[model samples]
Target: VAGQFGKSAVAAAPTLLTKELTFNFQQKRSIQLAMVELEDMPVRSEAEELVFSLLIAILPERLPEQTQLLSNYPNPFNPETWIPFELSQDSKVSVTIYNVAGTPVRNISVGYLQAGSYVSQLKSVYWDGKSDTGERVSSGTYFYQIRAGDYTETRKMVILK
Candidate 1:
């Protein structure tokens, strides 16, 4: 089978196996058979090199080490403040601001973002200290929650009207 396929196809087959195959007995047998067939082929340095390159290209890219929610600047803000966060990979992000009584005042949906650091300034993700209906909130403590993929975090802020 290895001899019948081109070098690129043969090289990519192993990568596909690891990604799509379960580690069950049948899968194991298939892997072993593939390895045996690969070994039986005549030694060709160029083919080996192509396989090596293909394997490297087929590997998945590295994800972020961790997701983080940084403290918002100007904690005791007047009408607005910047909320910052970092993501290791693409994710759907939602930010919600709740009053001290736990009532949701503002909900900001950031949609999908790629892996990187994002600030309210650069990304325009800031909350204008207003309710969803565009009314300014009263002065007091409030909670801001950030939900990104599997990560969830809540932080406190104050509004000094």
Candidate 2:
């Protein structure tokens, strides 16, 4: 039976299935196993009666585009929230938090980053709803701006005390 399929045929069968399969991970900083269903296959020979299970390690997808300043998560947060961003290439990055009155509260300098996508959980860059002086800021709407090379963007976030 194995001779009919050949060793390479059995070994490479899983690779062919993955070509039509897409993986999606819902959580950050976590590993999960998900079963995917493939299209129905027709049994051609007795050798094909052998069943095989394939396991593929999935990773987060990447967005290879221009620099982007993504929004902070858990908005209307009490103390802290995550900030995520993406860099298409290596560049100096800076993130600043400002109050509604247009005053800079905290400045986070990322310095230099390579070209890739970055998430707060992976990068550990978060805002603790505090000013640079280590004092907690009032609850309200705030803005965060990212300056990376010549690519700049501003986004709004909410803090709920």
TM-score of each: 0.59, 0.62
In the range 1-161, model 1's lDDT, one tens digit per residue, is 86666766766676777576445534444444444454457774776556445544443332335788888888899989999988866789999999888999999999988765686587746988889999999999999999999999999999997
- Cα-based lDDT for every prediction: 0.75, 0.70
Model 1 residue 128 CA deviation (Å) reads: 0.6
Per lDDT, the best of the predicted structures is 1
* Structure candidate 2, residue pairs in collision: none
Model 1, C-alpha of 30: deviation from truth (Å): 31
lDDT of 2 by residue, 32-97 (tens): 212212113443334333332333223224434577877688877889988888887678988899
* CA error at residue 31 for candidate 2, angstroms: 24
**Candidate 2 off by > 4 Å:** 1-63
Superposition TM-score, candidate 1 onto the true structure: 0.59
